[model samples]
Target: MLALIGEALLAYVVIVAVQILINDGLFGLAKVFVQRIRDLPGVDLLIGAVIKREADSFLRQIDSKRSPTVEMSIKIPEKGISHDDLREEMKQLKGEEVNLDDGQIFAYVYTAQNEHYKAMEDAYLAFTDTTGTGTEKGDTDHETLVREFLRAFMHENALNPIVFPALRRFETETAAMAADMLNGDANVVGSLTSGGTESILMAIKTYRDRARSLFPHIKSPEMVAPITIHPAFEKAAHYFDVKIVHVPLDSDFKPNLDKYRQAITSRTILLLASAPQYCHGIVDPIEEIGNIAREKGLPFHVDACFGGFMLPWVEKLGYTVPKFDFRVEAVTSISADIHKYGYGLKGASLILYRNSDIRKYQLFAYSEWPGGLFGSPGMTGSRPGGNIAASWAALRAIGQDGYLRMARRLMEATLALRDGIERIPGLAILGKPEMTAFAIASTDSHLDILALADAMEEKGWRMERQQFPNSLHCTILPHHVTLVDKLLNDLRESAENVRGKKAKGGTAAIYGMVGKIPDKAIVDTFIKQFLSDVYTCKT
Candidate 1:
C-alpha cells in the first residue's frame, strides 16, 4: 500500500509540471501572434496616414480664415526661373489682405518685444553678410566661428576626460551647479544630453543596466512612475524593453506614494517622480518617495527638465517647494533642461547621477570596432558644439539676477491668468500648480474645453488642448505678462460665445475619438505615420 501511494504522488507531480510547460508555451505563442498582427503589411502605414490627415485637417481648420485664397502656379517652359525673380515671386505669395502684424500670434515669437526682435534680426543680417573665400566657404567660416564658440563654451565632449580636459571640467562644474540648485551632494554626477527626452532615456537606461548588474537572476525589469511623468519615460520603456507600472495621481494631481509602494517588486529597477510635471504642473511627493526608494534600495530619478531652471530661483524668491533633488538620500539622478527656463537656445539639457559608479552604465564604448575605439557618453554622434556655446552664453548673459527677475514676472503673470480663468463660471483649474504652466478644464458637462480653445484661437490666441480629462493648457513666459489682461478678456468673450455648445467638428472631436480607441497599438502606428508625413515636403 505504501509503494502504491508514493507512485501516485510522483505521477501527480509530473502532471503539474506538464501543465506549467503548456501554459508557458501558450503565452509565448499569443505574444508572437500579436507581434505578427502589428507587422502585417499596410496596417501601420494606413493608420499613420489617417492620423496625419486628421492633424493636417485640424491645422487647416485653424488657419482657414487666415490662409491666402490665391494659389500661385508657375509655367516651367522646360526652364527654371532666375533665383532672384523666383524669390520676388515667392514674396508676392504672401497674403496681401491678411494683417501680418506683431504681438498677434502666441509662443512662436519668443522675443516679440520690438527692441529684442530688432536686435536679433540685425544680428542675423550681420552674420549673413560676413563672407569668406566663396559662398559655401563663407557659410562654412560662419558656422566654424559658431562651432568654435560653442566648443569653447562647453569645453568640448564630455565623454573623454583624457582627450578633452576642459570639456570634462565644464561638465563637472555644470553638474555641480545643477546638483547645488537641486540640493544634491558633491558626490552627485551627471551627463549632458540633447534634450529632456534623451535625459530621461539615459536615466532609464542607467537604472536598467544597474539592475541587471546587481540582480542577474531577474529576467524582466519594471519601473514605477506617476502617470503625469513625461511620456518620454514611456518611450524609454518601449525602446529598452521594460514594463512600466503607472501609478494614479491624487486629488492634488501628485502621484500617490502608497500605491507606488504596493507596486514595488524585486523586478522593479527604478522609481520616478517629477518636480511639477508638464501635464497639470503639480509636483509629486518626492521626500516620501525618496524614503521608499531608500528602503527598497531602488534608484530614484527626478524629472525636473521643465521646472529645474525656474524652481531653484523661484524657491530663492520665497516659494514653498518640496525637496525633490539629490538632497534626498534616496534620489539618485536628476534631469534638467537649459533651453526652457534656463533661457538657452534649444537642444541642451543635463542628466545628473549620484556618483561616478552609477554613471558608468550610461557610457557606450566599443573597442573592437573596425573604425577603432568608438565611445559616446550620450545618444548622438557628431554632436553640435554651437548649441553648447549658446547654452553657455545664455547662462552667463542671463546671470542670477536676470533669471530671478524673469521668474518673478512669469509667476506674477501666471497667477493673474490663473485667477482670471478661475473667475470663468464653467471652467475649473486641473490642479494646484505652483509654476507658470497650468491646465483649465470645464466643470459643466455641456461646456467643451476644445471648443473654447478653438474660439480662443479665432481671437488670435493659441492655447494647447489636452485629453484624458479634456482641458486647455497654457505656458506663461515674460512676453505673456503684457497680454494677460487681453487674453483673459478674449477668453471670457470666447467662453460666452461657446456657452451651451457641444464639442463637435474641431480638435475636440478628433481628440475625443482618439482617446476612446481600445487598441493602443493602432494609435501608436498612426502617430508614427503622422510624424513621417510632417517631414515630407510639398512642392
Candidate 2:
C-alpha cells in the first residue's frame, strides 16, 4: 500500500508540472527542448560548418582565386615614389576601377558637368593648407580667383568659431539657406555633420538624451519608423542603445498609417518618415505621420537625405510632391545630405532642429579634460574644412535656377525610363517614385531580376541589386540624363537573356541565396564574414 501511494504521488507531481508548463505557454517548453537539441553533440559543429560554408561561398563568388590561407610578408615603404611615378601608379589603379564618366553606372557618382565638377575640385585644392598655399597653377581667370577666394578658409578648423569666424559664417549661412528652403522659421537651427549617417546618429543621440532628462518613467526608449527607411537608422539605434520598432509598408509601398499608429507605445520617443525612401523612391505620408506624432506628443524626424535637395526644386517645377519639410508642424528635426542631390562633395550633411531648445541636447561639453575645457556641437572634434567649403561652394554655385533645371531634367528622364520599363512585358517600376531614383522588378517569376542584373553587368552597365522582393535600383543623375535609351535597351536584352533561368553562380547567385534564406541571422553572419574577407588584405 505504501509503494502504491508513493507511485501515485509521483504521477500527481508530474501531472501538476505539465499543467504549470501549459499555463506558462508551450512556447517556453518548446524553447527549452530546442535548447537541449542545440546542446547535443555535433550541433554546434554543424552550425559552424554551415556558417563557414556560406561565408566561403560568398568569398568565392567575389574573388574566385583567393586562397584559403594567406602567407604573405609585410612590405614597409621606406622611401616615397616620385610625383610622376605616383601619377602613373594612380592612373594604373584607376584603370582597375569602373569608369563613371561614361554614364554606364546606375548610381554612386553624381556630377553635373565637367565645368561644375572642376570648380568644386579647384575650390577644394585651393583651401588645402594653412599658409594659403594653393594649386601649382596660378589663378589667371575670374573663375580661378573666385575659387581661390572660396578656399581661403580651407585650412581653418571649424571646431573653434571664435578662432575662425568665417567658417562659422559659412556654416550659419548655409544652415539658414537650407532652413529657408525647407520653410523653417526664425527658430530653426542645425549643425553640419560628416554625412547622413552622422546626422542620423546625432538625431538619435539627442532624442535618447532628451528622453533620459524628461521622461524618467520610461525605462527603455523606442523609435517608430517605416521598415523602408534607410539602414543608417538601424545603425544609429544600435549605437545609441535605442530600440527601433518598424512598421510595414502598404500595398502602395508607403507606410501603412493604421499599423504605424498601432506600433506606437508609451516608450516611443521619436517618429520617423522619409521624403522618398531609397528602395522604391515613394515618399511616405509625412504629413499624416506628423499628425500622428503630434497626437502622440512624440518628436517627428523627416529623413530627406536623398530627396531634400531635389524635391523643393521638383515642386517648384510643378511636380506634385508631398510636403515633407518644416511645413509639417510636428516635424521637430530633419536630416539632409548635401553630398547627394545638392551637388556637394561627399561627406557633408545637415541635422536641423525646429528650435534651439531641442538642439541643446545634441551638444557635448567636458570641463575637466586635461587639455582644456572642450565642447563640440557635432560628432567629430576635428572636421575637414575642405568638405564644408566645397559643399558651401556647390550650394552657392548651383543656385535655385541651377537646381530647378537639374530637377526638371532628372524628373523627365525618370518618367521616360519608367515608361520604357513598363512597356517591357515582364518588367515594371516598383512604385510611383516621386523623384529621380526608382527600382525595377520582374513581374514574371521565371524572369530572375538577379540574373537580369548579371547580364546587364556583362554589358558594361552597373545596376545596384536590392533584396526582399528582388529588384534592381536605378538613380538618374545629371550624367545619366542622356543615357536613358541606352539603359533601357540593355535592360531589355538582359531580361530576354535571363528569362526562364536562375542565378547559379557569381554575385547574382550570392544575392539569390541571401533573398531566399529563411533565417535572417544566418544571412547576417554570412554578410559579416563576407565583409571581413573583403577588407582582409592578403599580406
Q: Could you say which candidate leads in TM-score? A: 2
Q: Report each candidate's C-alpha RMSD, comma-separated, in the order given.
A: 20.3, 21.0
lDDT of 2 by residue, 387-424 (tens): 66555545554567667767888889899999999998
Q: Where does model 2 exceed 4 Å of error?
A: 1-152
Clashing pairs in 1: 150-389, 189-353, 190-352
Q: After superposition, how far is residue 117 of candidate 2 from its true place, in Å?
A: 24
- Count the clashes in each prediction: 3, 0
Candidate 1 overall lDDT versus native: 0.71
Q: Please estimate how well model 2 matches the true structure, expressed as its whole-model Cα lDDT.
A: 0.77
Provide the overall lDDT of each model, using Cα atoms, as 2-decimal numbers.
0.71, 0.77
Runs in model 1 with CA error above 4 Å? 1-166
